[model samples]
Target: MLMPHPKDMRTLLSRYATARLAHAERQTLKSATQLDDVSYTLCVATATTEINDALAAADRILAQPPPAASSRP
Candidate 1:
């Protein structure tokens, strides 16, 4: 059996994040049209909070140092 690669895992995670961000954007737009004053405000606030959290998480992941390569014979 073949082992999974770290780069492939990272690519999958990046794709998942992108998809989630798009979904959040769509929800924000949909809520803007359908929610009343208070509800809309709450929805917008929640969406903003989620976006900020996602950004921070992504930043932290990207900031991690790359793994050192092995030097084998």
Candidate 2:
């Protein structure tokens, strides 16, 4: 399985957080739509079917240390 880069995952997480809060506060169709979009993107990126599972997966990924830098002569 392929993994997303930490930076990309972070961006996705940010989008999810924003969308989640926006929908929670306003409860408008627009906010709901945005939340759905972000939720799907988050699921796809994390390779999980459920939002809760995807969130846990994301947390696991974020908790990991970044890859060591490569040195080339």
Candidate 3:
């Protein structure tokens, strides 16, 4: 899969983490909406349709020594 630019990928991943944390804490309407937005954005950035798939795609892109990297699971 095509990878996002290094800096952009970091931003996407950071947003993903924040949105996920908000979700895990509680599924409030606002947080849920934010998560949906972030998830959709992440999906688009990763060239995926589903959230899990998008996450995996992000992880894969991040795993390679992308000219850098992260630990996700």
| Residues 3-32, model 2: lDDT tens digits | 777788899999999998999899999999
Order the candidate numbers by TM-score, best to worst. 2, 3, 1
- TM-score of every candidate: 0.35, 0.87, 0.76
Selected candidate, larger TM-score, 1 vs 2 = 2
Strongest candidate by lDDT: 2
Worst 10 residues of 2 by lDDT: 64-73
Error of 3 at 33 (Å): 0.5
Task: Give candidate 2 regions above 4 Å deviation.
Answer: 69-73
Per-residue alpha-carbon lDDT of candidate 1 for residues 2-73, written as tens digits (9 for 90 to 100): 222345335544555555566567767544444333333332433433544534444454566654566221
Backbone clash pairs for candidate 1 read: none
Q: What number of backbone clashes does candidate 1 have, counting pairs of residues 3 or more apart or in separate chains?
A: 0
Whole-model lDDT per candidate: 0.44, 0.88, 0.83
Comparison by TM-score, 1 against 3, better one? 3
Model 3 per-residue lDDT at 62: 76
TM-score of 3: 0.76
